[model samples]
Target: MTNLYRSRAMQDAEMSNSSFLPSLPSELLFHILSYLDIPDLLSISRTMHYLRTISLDPLLHTYRLQRASVILSRAIPSRPPLTELMARRVYITRTTLTALNLGRSLTMIRLKRQLERRPTVERLIELGVLPPECYLNQSNGISTTLGLYRRRKVVQKEKVRNFLAEWIGELSKRITRRMIDSSRSTRDASSL
Candidate 1:
């Protein structure tokens, strides 16, 4: 009789937990995700592959970009007319591109450091993100640096700003389009 009671209790526990395991709809998940702070979201995303994919939804990417822009706006110098594009270019490194977690903060520190430089043209050339032909003079020092190729992209502040503007604009547009498409699809599905 005790064995039978124990089995019955186990069955009841399973029944109670069954609905608890039901999958959350992606819409609800996204809503929840939006409410989470960036750090929390990043932590959750890094914990598992499934979550990482969800967090990387196109809309989420747009959200991250917007957040980065806000952070940049607050951090950059006010007087010199630093465009969002310029902030992005210097801040958005290869690693940061893949992960939104530390991208904006890291970019802020790097940008601040670069701005306090001696303000020379060579320093600018060294920091510029322009292609070799754009800023590097053929007879200049950067052209032949430590057994390097004749033409290499130099990342300067101005160049960085241009690159950031172009790349971020393209990305932002694509993300906007995706967001529009996703909403339309949801509306259609609900109406059906």
Candidate 2:
């Protein structure tokens, strides 16, 4: 009942708590873990001794290492498209990523899961890596093409504002719910 004894008892309780893993085979467990997202897997690994002990499988680890090498090589801007294409996969080159990052409105659309389904012929166009002709309106001749850009400049400004408003408005509800739940949890913990 002394403070030192209570602390020692709590330590022992925590140690014993880690020893009672369910009787799943390690391979099966690893398979299940592989299906989990990084967040969920990391959370489980933190609390479960069995999961923490699981090593990355050799084949999976090697595959990731190889893929990473190609990803890095292809991602280098100086590498030619043909040279990078010869590699396993042509990742978004660092130059393209940098261009996209510099364009805030493009990044916003990308993060909103809208880029993949964009009406543009290619998502790569938004990266600003494409030729100017790709963005040109084919129906319009040269003079009207210049006018098109001016008109689109106005339209894009409005679109960016609307997208920003939509983003903030969507997150506002999620933020309110989280704040309500957070305050409720704090109140319950204090009562305890």
Candidate 3:
């Protein structure tokens, strides 16, 4: 707010602190502040005594009460404690939403299905869910070769990708089968 209609005390407070909220019109200040929670209003009070005085003014609250009386019948509680529901209800800003976006990828879906259950390394290798070189000798809990780097040479990136796609596809099918079986049981129970 500008210094045009500011009182002597407000002008002095403004001069003392460089914490001015720029561009907010003085006329709208009270209206905006009224909507804010008690903690926020208290914080604002620390910035300027003028705001504190205005926030504490019984006249303002009385006016709010009178206005609210016409709209709301029940005394609703303030914000509830943070919970899963609260976290899920949060509105994501466009930038954050865009940054988080990873378009639906069939390869990832297929890979997730293929790797749904932690199968034996041998089984994984057999199903092409894991590259052949990634399979360790189960008896010793170590790779067949002493050279770990050499194993990487044998297991190319394309093989790994293919393995993942195969894994996810298998996992997806397993999940779908379980869902179908579950639905069939429910249907049978209802028929009985």
Candidate 2, lDDT over the whole model: 0.69
For residues 123-168, write the lDDT of model 1, one tens digit per residue: 5556774333444565555544422433233345568889999999
Best by TM-score: 3
Ranking by TM-score: 3, 2, 1
List residue ranges in candidate 1 displaced over 4 A.
1-22, 61-192
Residues 1-192 of candidate 2: C-alpha lDDT, one tens digit per residue: 699999999888976785645566776776665555557756876876667666335543454466678878888877677656736446666776677678977778677887556556345467766546446455665333445667777898999999999999999999999999999999999999
TM-score on alpha carbons, each prediction: 0.24, 0.26, 0.29
RMSD for all candidates, in order, please.
30.6, 23.9, 24.5
**lDDT values for all models:** 0.70, 0.69, 0.71
Better of 1 and 2 by lDDT: 1
Clashes of 1: 8
Model 3: per-residue lDDT, tens digit, 16-51? 665564335554777777676668877978877667
The local lDDT score (0 to 100) that residue 167 gets in candidate 1 is 100
Tell me the TM-score of model 2. Answer: 0.26
Q: Could you arrange the candidates by lDDT from highest to lowest?
A: 3, 1, 2
